[model samples]
Target chain A: MFGNIDRHTYITLSCVILEPNSPKISLARAGHMPFLVKQHGGVSVVTPRGLGIGLASAKIFDANLEEFSLELSVGDSCFLFTDGLSELQNPQSQDFGYEPMLDVLRSPASLSAQSIISEVMKSADSHAQGHPQHDDMTALAFIFKGTNKILSEYDSIPL
Target chain B: MNDVKFTIDHQSFGDVKLLKLQGYLDAHTAPHLESALGDLIQDGNHKIVVNFKELDYISSAGLGVFMVYIEDVRMTGGDIKLSEMKPKVFTVFDLLGFPMLFEIVEHDQIALSKFTA
Candidate 1:
């Protein structure tokens, strides 16, 4: 498959399939950052050992692929972001990094997924200190509020 | 935002070519890298080293450039050894597990030595 590309061209994907009225979701990743999960007042990352699609032979890519089923508790939140947030650099060339992003995820202002993204974006923007973003920065968050009310939001700052 | 800058400096040591990359490497700048590597491979110089000590950043697009040339060079009994990556630059590759596919060394000299050793 890679042969067709005059040069190496591949896609990085991180996907989660949701079920109706269920906390369980199917997840798959291809050369993407791990999903940031907020649970029990803490934050952690979940990533399977998967290489980017088209980066190697189908055999190798398939062998590395690992699909997972994750069940989140009602107050748990899941986030996936492009490197734009963590890779945000200040004038000094210091990146905002993941720790700060995790901090926001750990204790978002409110239970709403939008709040989670807003807090992180605000922090990331502050990290820039007037330095404009150079890459596409996208953030996604979903909160399993309950059987009826689920909050999710996607935000992006592209340059 | 301002335009991202990238440049490649190439030098040869025996059978291996060393390319020193500087500045940010993102989608807009990856083509330059593709051609730089493609040119070397076209010339039958497969053994190569990419020194990243000076590279400030690398997006997945830059990483994809490697996927394009790796198989070609390896088929000819040569390899691309990466070296001198900054912590941040390495993280981009590491997060995607590039270490498993490519040999990463601490210094450019270490990468060059591996070609002979």
Candidate 2:
């Protein structure tokens, strides 16, 4: 439908469906950045092949689209972000890039999902060096606490 | 003003049209690119090549412009071959699986050669 109405404008969608009370979460990406999985202090960028919406006919788009699944161990954190965050630039016109963004995901385990977002935003702001953002910036993050730990306001906070 | 400077330099090699893009391509500048591609398709010129050697930056919106025309051109026995994309520009395309859908060449001659060979 998008190819008919306005072919030039498109949307990137990243959907994570969590099975009830399970560490196994399924991810579907459509022309968006990959999701980050930080488990055991190692960062993995989970990129399932996907083309953005309105880029091709439904047949071709669906053919190329793929879904990925992974089981999260204790303290596994997953992060989703828009292209705006990684593409954020500083005064020198150099993009903040993925290396530093991944660095934020590698943060200590003491920090909750909330703090991860805060740390990334803070890092991006510092990298911007007073330059205004050029794109819509949005970030969402969540950590699997293994269904045993007491859920605090910080751990369960919806940001 | 949210505007960023973007320019397209056009050249014709036999049946193929080469468009050299320069400067930033964000939401503000995507329409200009869409119209340019639309005009080319309208003129019955589908064998196209886009040189990203000079393009400094591309946003998600800019990336969508290629999607708008790929199917239309491909159905008509032609294709849009992208060439000479800087590492940064190529990285953005790779992020969204564009390389699988489009032919990305390392040089303009390679892209142009694919049209005839």
Candidate 3:
């Protein structure tokens, strides 16, 4: 919606947005990567193929919007990261990929978004062994506690 | 690896300064370009013509930085323009769909003329 075909590289992007007052959170993917959702002792992967917007003649690719839901109790968390993290190559020239990522999640260390992201970056950096970040690194983790957990945490926030 | 070099020059076609980029705009070095443009925008110089005559490569993340700031630049009553992109970079641009949104020209003088006129 910004520019014509010859001026602006239009790589539109979309993601699953959780809204308030909705019965369930929604998930969508468009020319982007998947997000991780964790609940009830299990991990979920949500990735759909959508054309990267600005690629030449990428119109042939179809955009897909898919949703999956999980019942929540307490202490459930979701994680998301860009390829930079998954694709990070260690000093041994191997990727500190999904397995390590899952390991991090299994550990108790990945309870909060900031801590999870920081630890992942540190792990990747350590694996790289002083190699420059070949790509921009980004990560997001969301812990889903029940409504009671939300209220309790909210009540504790100092005004 | 230092295929592209950037420099800032003040031109008085009428009364504006021109900050020019003469290098590859790719992932490996785009952070510097982003910061340069960022500083200029922060300093309130909105009108810009990125002379891409010497530009060699650009990646999606590199493009993202521009897309991220384009709104801010336009909001300030300034625009980002392009000129003299080598065919190599243009191919990258065309492949990525950037040509559709940017003002790309074939010559540096033409880009400057557009800014003045």
lDDT for residue B88 in candidate 1, whole number 0-100 = 80
TM-score of each: 0.81, 0.87, 0.48
lDDT of 1 by residue, A51-153 (tens): 7766766887788788888777888888888877777889998888788778887774747777887898899988899998877888888888765555554
- By DockQ rank, best first, the candidates go 2, 1, 3
lDDT of 3 by residue, B37-105 (tens): 787778777877776665555556566656656767778777777777777566545434455556788
Which has the greatest lDDT?
A: 2
In the range A61-133, model 2's lDDT, one tens digit per residue, is 8998889988877778888999888888888998877777688878674367778878888889999999999
Worst window of 10 by summed lDDT in candidate 3 chain B: B3-12
Candidate that would win on DockQ: 2
Top candidate by TM-score: 2
Sort the predicted structures by TM-score, highest score first.
Answer: 2, 1, 3
lDDT of 2 by residue, B1-117 (tens): 333489888999999999999888888888888899899999999999999998998887798788778888999999999999999899889877788789999999999989989
Residues A48-68 of candidate 3: C-alpha lDDT, one tens digit per residue: 444455432433433222444
Candidate 2 ranges with C-alpha deviation above 4 Å: A147-159, B1-4
